[model samples]
Target chain A: MRKLINQKEHFIKDMLDGLKFHDQKISIIEDSIVVRKVKKESGVAIVSGGGSGHEPAHAGYVADGMLDAAVCGEVFTSPTPDKILAAIKAVDNGDGVLLVVKNYAGDVLNFDMAKELAEAEGHNVATVIVRDDIAIDNAEQRRGVAGTVLVHKYAGYLSGHGSNLQQIVEKVENMMESLHSIGMAVHPCLVPTTGEFGFDLEEDEMEIGIGIHGEKGIYREKSETVDKIAGRLLSELLPHNDDNDIILMINGMGGTPDSELLIVTKYVMEALEEKGKTVHKLLVGNYMTALDMQGFSLTIVSHNDELLKSLNAPTESTHY
Target chain B: MRKLINQKEHFIKDMLDGLKFHDQKISIIEDSIVVRKVKKESGVAIVSGGGSGHEPAHAGYVADGMLDAAVCGEVFTSPTPDKILAAIKAVDNGDGVLLVVKNYAGDVLNFDMAKELAEAEGHNVATVIVRDDIAIDNAEQRRGVAGTVLVHKYAGYLSGHGSNLQQIVEKVENMMESLHSIGMAVHPCLVPTTGEFGFDLEEDEMEIGIGIHGEKGIYREKSETVDKIAGRLLSELLPHNDDNDIILMINGMGGTPDSELLIVTKYVMEALEEKGKTVHKLLVGNYMTALDMQGFSLTIVSHNDELLKSLNAPTESTHY
Candidate 1:
């Protein structure tokens, strides 16, 4: 694919510059180099950071009603502990700070070390590891996916309202238990520098439960109608859907058009309706996306009206 | 090439259903079949709409602080007069409504008729036809591209503040003349059901001044580095640059990533800096994307600090 880039290595820094250019409140620390734009007044600041390819996930959620600081790593790479620690310090408002992390081993370890460093500085710190993906053999060790967005929204609401570190951790932990996510890919994504397709899939086939970092999936099958796809995926997600309401997310991997995403959401809603499940809140867009990958994912968060109300609260950002 | 639809013919309606489902206040008028969401407020309301497939373009922008109502047509097809009329009526709040139309023959004619109908209904109405694209053979009849977004921002800003009909019309008309845009595409986009690419280019080629509606472009050349690509495109756009300050938009056609967009913007900024031009405000993203086509366009609106302030105004929407 043709791309408008100066050098592959400079892509992330240039992107960060443009992001900061568009929103001047966003400042990159010269030493640690975390991309943070908004500041919290007096609360337990919430910080989440990860790779760069997912454009709107961590940083885009940094605004008044969402995350306060987002430290970005290289494309699909975890940030160093120093960068994470810097973000924690930047957003710390004397109350405490919460680190929201995905379940990838690198991300978990890095944020954990950063948490220790923050505590060593005499600042109270806690962490919530979101392991919401259900596409793996070990549900306990499943890597986090787009469901992290819901965690960010809820945690931001709590932090914005001045929740203590313990309260924030407990709330996010509750949300983590209620969310399950799964994804599928049509064509693999190509890394910018190497131009290597992250994973392989046949032209007429799709791989379900694929990792955003180009990891292999659990199943490969011929592509079907979106309704069939939704059924197969949600079956694994909603095993006990008899009584819970859900906040449904139909997210593009990156390159999937909004038309296709809406189509997929159509089936997802139908599947929910068929199971007599209530969809209290729904978001369909490229919330967390891969780099030009042709696929999408479904995230179902079982929640009550309170979580739904919190998710619907308004915020300002370039991408919502 | 894979899709989620059961059949091609139902794609638009299904997507509309998904949009309405997530947005409860939004509904389709059965008689006119215009899709719009009502803002439960007593203030003056603004309505805008256009062709579909530019996902998050018109519809995603129709939430708080932007547009009160957005009417969508079929993929790349203009809405009928009745549809536009319905949208105006749906959002009218006695303070009059403004119609923001991209400069295209069909969009102009249809929205004009809608304005007449709205006026006939005792609802004050104003229209601003955006002719901002610099790629046209004739500047007077230039086609509007993504720079209409600036118009949307300013007009929405004024309308949100309850500006009178005469005030809104004058401001939008004055603003339209100062906006100039130009775009290119690496490949043609497929209409959802057809699954066929609109136009084809060699692996190393691009088409400049490509229309958002798939109109033929002015130039086709071998694709080059981001700097060289920016050089060629800026050359075509600079002759019309005639403002002391300007707002710049480096917009993705849909499929391009932020990594590539910043690279494109780097050269674009360099070219502007060489002329000693000042870009007071900049927006870079998929503002008015053309499906999943892998390409981008540049837009600059010559304006004073007032317009710059309005452009920087906070907006709440799915995509900003």
Candidate 2:
């Protein structure tokens, strides 16, 4: 695939620079490549980072009423601890900082190291590892996916409202207890540098519970109707939801239109209603999108009224 | 080409149903297929309508601080006069109503007929046709594209602030006089029922000035760098202006990433800045997108401080 990139290695940096071009309210730290709140931010700062292919996932959500800082790695790869550490320090206020880390192994280790580094510098820090995907064979071993967007939103609410690092971490952990996400892939997206798909699937089939980084999904099947897809996704998530109120997310893999995402949400709502569950909060869009993949995911999180209200809080971001 | 459509004939209705499923405030008229204001619009209600493929074009812009109603038709086809008239009536208050129509042969004719119908009924009405596309051969006969979004935004601001129909029409006409848009397509999009691409281009080439309905562009050549693409698009538009302040819009054609769109916007900014023109506003996203087509369009609209300030006003809509 022909792309408009300067150099394969510089793609991520250039993309980040482009993001900062129009919105002067956002500034990226030179050399370190970390984005921080340009406006004065008080209280605990929430810092999140991940691979860069998901355009609005980690960075676009970093605006007022959301994240304080965001770090980006190369597409589908975790950022080094140094990058994470730089982001943590840039946004660290007197109240300390909280790191919202996803559950991918590379992401977990790197963020954990950064947390230790921040602590060594006398900065009070806490980490919340979001493990929301439910597609793996061992549920305990599944990795994080689209649920990370919710973690950022929920964590941002706590941190933005003056919660300390520890308090914010506790809130995120409580939310994670009932959060589950599952995604499917219609086709593999080509990495710009390689000009080859990250994975491969037949034209008539799709992969379910696929990882964002082109990791193999747990199941492969022929492409089905939106209602059936929603049924399967909800079936996997609703079983463990002990809370009566659920926060549901219908996310696209970047390529689907909002119209289709809403159709997925329609089926999801019907699925929940048939199960006699109350959906307290709902979001359907390309939040936490994969790269040009045509499919949708479902994320269900058990939440209290406070969490529900926080999830729906107003946020100013480029893509939100 | 795998789409989320239920049936070829029911695509528009089903898509609108999906949209209403997400936003409860949107109500679709059954017979007319017109989406109108859920809350009573006290001021002169602003109504807009156009082809259907551009998801969130008209309907997505209708909300608390935006358009009062939007009428829909088949993909890339203008709505019937009956549908447009129904939309105007559904949103019309005692004050009056202003119809914002794009400058296409079909859209202009249909909306004009609707305006006449509404006027014959003794309801105050006015119409403003936006002709902003600069990619066509002759300036006098160019079609409308992304610049229509700016018209909708400004018209929404005026009508929402209680401007009369004549006042709103004057404002819209003035805005249209200073607007120009140009677009390119990397690949052709498929129409659902026929399952055929709207146009054809070589794998290593792109078409400039591609119409919104998958019509042929004026120029076809080997794909160039995004910077060059932006340069070419702005080159055509900048001549129409005598170096005035303008708002810049880099809009995705449904399938491009926000990251890539930002890159395209970067080039557009550089091109405009090189000409010593000031950009008072910048918007980058998938506004007025084709159906999953891989490309983007740039729109420049000259504006005064009033329009600039109004552009930044808080808007609550699904696709703002």
DockQ of each: 0.51, 0.51
The Cα local distance difference test for each model comes to 0.77, 0.77
In the range B150-257, model 1's lDDT, one tens digit per residue, is 777787788667677788888888877777888998766766757777788786788898888667888888877777788888888877775556778898887776
Q: Residue A285: error of model 1 in Å?
A: 2.2
TM-score of each: 0.89, 0.95
For candidate 2, the per-residue lDDT at A121 reads 92
Minimum summed lDDT over a 10-residue window in model 2 chain B is located at B31-40
What are the per-residue Cα lDDT tens digits for candidate 2 across B1-320?
36655556777766776677677777888632545436564888878878888876877887767888888878788999988888777877788887878778888889888889988987888887777887776766778788888777787777677677788888777777878888888867766657787788777788888877767777899988777887887777688777467788888887776667766766777777888888888887888988777788888777698788778877777676
Model 2 lDDT, residue B283, Cα: 85
TM-score of 1: 0.89
Error of 1 at B151 (Å): 2.5
User: lDDT by residue for model 1 over A19-132, one digit each (tens)?
Assistant: 666666667674225444546668888889888788777777777777888888888899999889888888897989888898988899999999899899988889888887
C-alpha lDDT of residue A79 in model 1: 91
Chain B TM (all candidates)? 0.92, 0.95
